[model samples]
Target: MPTPGFPPSTLDSEGTPIWISDLAGGDPNHVLHVVRGIEAEDALEALGAKPGLIRSCELPDSKPDEWTSLPCAALGVEPGGSAALLAGRVGEWTFVYDDSGFTYDDAVTKALSADGRTAATSVYTINGDASLTYAVDGEQVEWVNFDDLELDEGFAGMPAELRAAFEAAGNVETEDFEPGEADGDILMRAACALAGLALTLDDVRRVPLLVVPFG
Candidate 1:
């Protein structure tokens, strides 16, 4: 059985998984985007690569520009996997592929090359409507919305302890507390991770996901 409130895993009329590329092809307005998971290859295949990929690393112990910063989480990375793959739209959104057995610097370089852009270390994070929006066959998906998708998926892998934390947080309710007040768990978890706090799976589940904030 499926959860009643959550978005359904997309299916076709015949109950087949819909390939985003096929969906996007029929109506250019339907852009299928993925930020986390083993779905990047599929997303790229569907949308095709655009020019000028940018990448950056998140710095622990400091809050970088919110809209233009990476998650500086200590994801328990091991040797030979010191850096995360901070790829995607450079400043706007980054998908941290940690323990990827790759260097962050090198991964960023390759990503930039894929779009035929000369990689530069000290470039201004792309801004403006042009920078925030991505198109597939001319359909637009805003990066702001895309970040929510990534954050949600990221928590999907969080340990059970964190989930309990969330359940606990969700319990503290007051007549004065707005519906949005329930999201403190999501903020705490994501902020902890973004600030390089050691994360347990328990922590992951407890994090309040700020979905509507981005939307």
Candidate 2:
């Protein structure tokens, strides 16, 4: 109906909506990685997380702002040198949400996509810029940025349909967001839509994951 994943998702509990806009409105800094065909533990290990510190937990039943310190402290992590992230398999995609921007690297995004996994990364910066990078089987296909608003470069291998979706995801307009409040979610939506992941806020809330102190 809605092009499979475009438009700000909304649900009584999931989809894109004020929840995402609110996340950006409050912190505007985080990294969300969606990797297709990988388990939660494999996703963490792929990202260089130590196996010992990895702990099983449910997504915090709290707001995102409190996540930075609370989870890391509980995991005995300093919450400074490395980021405490939540990773889990939800359907065909493994979602990793980094409250701290520690995993916000293009190399890391491509690395996850390596060895037969398809991955997409959405990076939201405190300076109000955001980006979505799409990769396949370990190679970077393309990347688009909110600040520059450019879709050119690294798109040669990407299909026309996906490229068009990226265009659509970036150009989404809604009064739901105040100034600069939707960039992160927009990129996130683009990533999910492009990668064919159906996500809900309830899944984010209810999924079982291995929490890790990731550098």
Candidate 3:
């Protein structure tokens, strides 16, 4: 059996391979938050990497023809949906046809790299059916994808608050930030924002966004 921190998850019962990213929910010590697929190979390839990709089969089919709403419900960003929603808005991404053929380092590097403007970090597993159990007890780790967050101008300067939340979370400025590339700093900040809401490590599993509840 593969332990935590391993890469490239095995195929589910439906023959679909599960891709997990360490969204880590709120607990810095914890790992793995959301599990989804690597949608949009062109998005990945545009990021610069070998072909072969996976995408989430659970995405909203019809497109809403309007975007003039205050909090656009179309913002429809499922924590466990396909990366296509986020990656499609940004850049290209390719899928991996064979897991054994590629090394974990290579796959991770490709996902983490900013070559194609944006790419997924990698995949992991969520463990048992006791989903909440993962974040409870002594050891808690939730797997989440970085691409799922609706991180645009709506979350530009949210770093200060995010940094205070997660010990492992911080900013990583780089000249590499392209015109349309998603900023990692903003992403990390948003992660923290979401963390503030989580009391126990388990409370933050398969999270949606850095939503801070109003007092």
Best by TM-score: 2
Question: Which regions in candidate 3 have their CA more than 4 angstroms from the true location?
Answer: 1-41, 46-87, 90-106, 110-124, 128-215
lDDT of 1 by residue, 71-112 (tens): 223222332222222222222222222212122232333342
lDDT of 1 at 60: 39
lDDT of 2 by residue, 105-203 (tens): 888989999988788888877776778888888888878776655334524555675565554454333565444333335576666556554445554
- Per-candidate TM-score against the hidden true structure: 0.21, 0.73, 0.21
Which stretches of model 2 miss by more than 4 angstroms?
1-25, 63-82, 150-161, 164-184, 195-198
The lDDT of model 1 is: 0.24
lDDT score at residue 107, model 1, on the 0-100 scale: 34
Best by lDDT: 2
- Candidates' lDDT values, in order? 0.24, 0.64, 0.25
Worst 10 residues of 3 by lDDT: 128-137
Total colliding residue pairs, candidate 1 = 15
How do the residues 1-215 of candidate 3 rate in per-residue lDDT, one tens digit apiece? Answer: 12111122322222112221122221111111211223334433433433433233322233233311111113343322212222221112222211111222323333433332222223222231111111111122332334443323433333433323222322232476554443333332223223222122122222222111010
Worst 10 residues of 1 by lDDT: 122-131
Q: Is candidate 1 or candidate 3 better by lDDT?
A: 3
